[model samples]
Every structure is written in C-alpha cells, then in structure tokens.
Target: MAEELRIRSNGDLASALEDYLAEWSGRSGIAVEIWALPGQAVSRRVAQAVYATVVEALANVERHSHARLVSVAVTTGKAGLRMTVSDDGAGFAVDEAAPNAARGLTAMRAHFAGVGGTLTVNSVPGGGTTVTGVVRAG
Candidate 1:
C-alpha cells in the first residue's frame, strides 16, 4: 500500500484502491463488486484511513466470512466520506464476538476514528456481514 501511495504521489485514492482490490480478489478468489468510488480527490488523511479500514474489513472477510462475493463502496458527500464493505458469507453473531476476540474489527474502527469517523458492523448468523464507516463533513 505504501508503495502504491508513493507511486501515485499519495493522492489518487481511487486508483490505489482499485489496484489493491484487484490483487486481493485475485489472490483470495473472492469476487469483488465495486459499487462506487469517489470521483473527486479526498484528503490524504481520510484516504489513508479509508484504505486501511477497507483492508482490514477484507482481511476479516477472507479469514472468517468464507464469502464468495464482496461488495465495496466509497463516496463523498455533504456527510463527508462513507465506505461500506459487505460480504455474502457466513456471518457471525455480532454480540457474541468480543472486541478482544476480533482485533480486526477494533483496528478497523480505530482507522475511522483516527479521521473523526465512526464504524458500524452488522451481521447475523448465516446471513452476512456489513462494515460501514462514516466521516462527517467539517
């Protein structure tokens, strides 16, 4: 990721994410459906946070979800930056999973919080998992 950022001068978040996702999906064998990506440039701090969060979210999906497909979306609006990583996999009980038990979730939340954003995770047994992050506009 660092290499990618450096190559793009650390401003093209969309391109960095695209390359990352393409490589990740190829290796994980999980089909990725990109729903949206910001057309405009985002702040470097916000971009890094979002990128790290997305990486962690996908890592969780690969490690635990057993998902065949994952959908990712990122957009910027009056609410600031919003991102969602949803997977059609074996979802676990959110309440049962302690914060300590799932360090990845904690890390993801921290990524967003570092940028004054909030993270939400929703999942149910046999259903699926959705990780959402929102950073409010200043």
Candidate 2:
C-alpha cells in the first residue's frame, strides 16, 4: 500500500489526492472531487509541494471550515502547473491574520515558495475559500 501510494512524479498527484480524499469523504460525507489535466507533467519537487498543499487545504476544510463540498482542480498551460482547492465551507477572513496563526496556511505557502511556486488564498467571511498554487513546471 505504501509503495502504491508513493508519488514519484506529478502524474501521480491527482489520483493520490483522490485516494486521500476518498477516505475522509466516505466517512465524513463531504463531497470532494479532483480534476487534473491529462498528460500534464511536473517535476518531482513541484509535485510533492503541490500535493502537500492539497493535503493541508483539505485538512483545513475538514477540521475548521465545516464545508459540505470540496473541489480540487489541477491544470498546466502557459501559466504553468496550477492546482486549486475550493471549499464551500464557513469561510473566514483571509486578511485578519490570527495572532496565534495556524501553521497549516503558513506551511502550505512555504511549500509552494520552496519549489519556486506561488500560493494564493482568497476567502471572505460566510463565503467559501479557494487556495491556488502555481509552479513553473514546463
């Protein structure tokens, strides 16, 4: 199972995410969907970073967002390899940084930066949250 789950490249990320979400969605009843651009390729480092970002984002929704639905989309084009995780949950202000900041968001940001990528988060109170990470993978 461990070997099967290992992600050696970007090609493995979509299914890995789907598998990861399947476990929680099955038990928690939150609808999670993953869509990836077919044939898009990314470096191992970028793949790992993006995968980590997705994990953190989904975990956040599960733990705090109280979201009923979550969607993760992956694509590659002129803008590069990008992944967006959106959740229809009880959103919070993205500007009002918590005094005791949650490390999840910070870690997700760092993961993208470490791979020469950018992470953008957009959210408003009572609205949903969208987290997007893009890396130059071409």
Candidate 3:
C-alpha cells in the first residue's frame, strides 16, 4: 500500500502533490493556487522540498491565516529554484528573522538553508503575506 504511494517517476511529483493537496484543501476549504512550468526535470530532493514547503505553508495558512485564498507558485531557472506561497490572511509579526520565530517557519527556513537556500517572510497589515524561499540545487 505504502509502496504504491512512493514516487518512482519524476514529473509526477507536482501532480501527486496537487491531487493530495486538492483533497486536503477541499476538506479544509482553502482555495489553493499552483503553477508549474513544463519540462521540469525533477529530482527526489527537489520534489521532497516542494512537498515539505507546500505542506508547511498550507499548515500555516490553516492555523494562522484565516485566509480565504492561498496562492502557491513554483519556478525553476538556471540561477536556482524559487517557491512562493502567498495568502490574504491576518498577518502577524516576526521582529527578527531568526531560526526560532515561528516553529514551522523556522523549520522551513532551516530546510532551505540546509540546501544552501534562503527563505524570506513578508507580511502586511492588511494586504497579505508572502513567504518566498530559494534552494540552490542546479
């Protein structure tokens, strides 16, 4: 059962995650937005990061945002990989961006930094929140 769920194909990662997230988000009433470029030659860690970060971001949206809409965008280029999760939620404060601000986000940042990447947290009083991370794998 679990073996069947394990991903052996590369391009299927995004769709798998999308399908899984679709059900989960539907249950939780989250409007999920996703964008993927074609011809993406995915590797294991790349897919893993995508899953991890999306899960983490959605969890945050569910717990903190109270956002009616959530947008997730992923783009890969010769420079590096970029993932942005934005939500129109009630934002909070993170005075000093450290490894301990928000437990989940702290972990997310660590995940990015672990692979020579960086995560930036941006929020507005009423506008929205956007979490952007870049992982250098290429």
Per-model C-alpha lDDT, please?
A: 0.86, 0.77, 0.72
Candidate 1 residue 29 C-alpha distance from true site, Å: 0.5
Most accurate candidate by TM-score: 1
Q: Once all C-alphas are superposed, what RMSD does model 2 give against the true structure?
A: 3.0
TM-score of 3: 0.82
- In candidate 2, what are the lDDT values of residues 21-86, reduced to their tens digit? 788689778998766542465676776787778778888888888898998788877777888999
Candidate 3 residue-wise lDDT at 103? 78
Candidate numbers sorted by TM-score from highest down: 1, 2, 3
Where does the lowest 10-residue lDDT sum fall in candidate 1? 1-10
For every model shown, what is its TM-score relative to the native structure?
0.90, 0.84, 0.82
Pick the lDDT winner: 1
Poorly placed runs, candidate 2 (over 4 Å): 1-5, 9-11, 96-100
Question: Candidate 1: where is the Cα deviation over 4 Å?
Answer: 1-7, 96-101
Under the 3 Å rule for N, CA and C atoms, how many clashes does model 3 have?
0
Candidate 3: global Cα-lDDT?
Answer: 0.72
Q: Which whole-number lDDT from 0 to 100 does residue 74 have in model 2?
A: 83
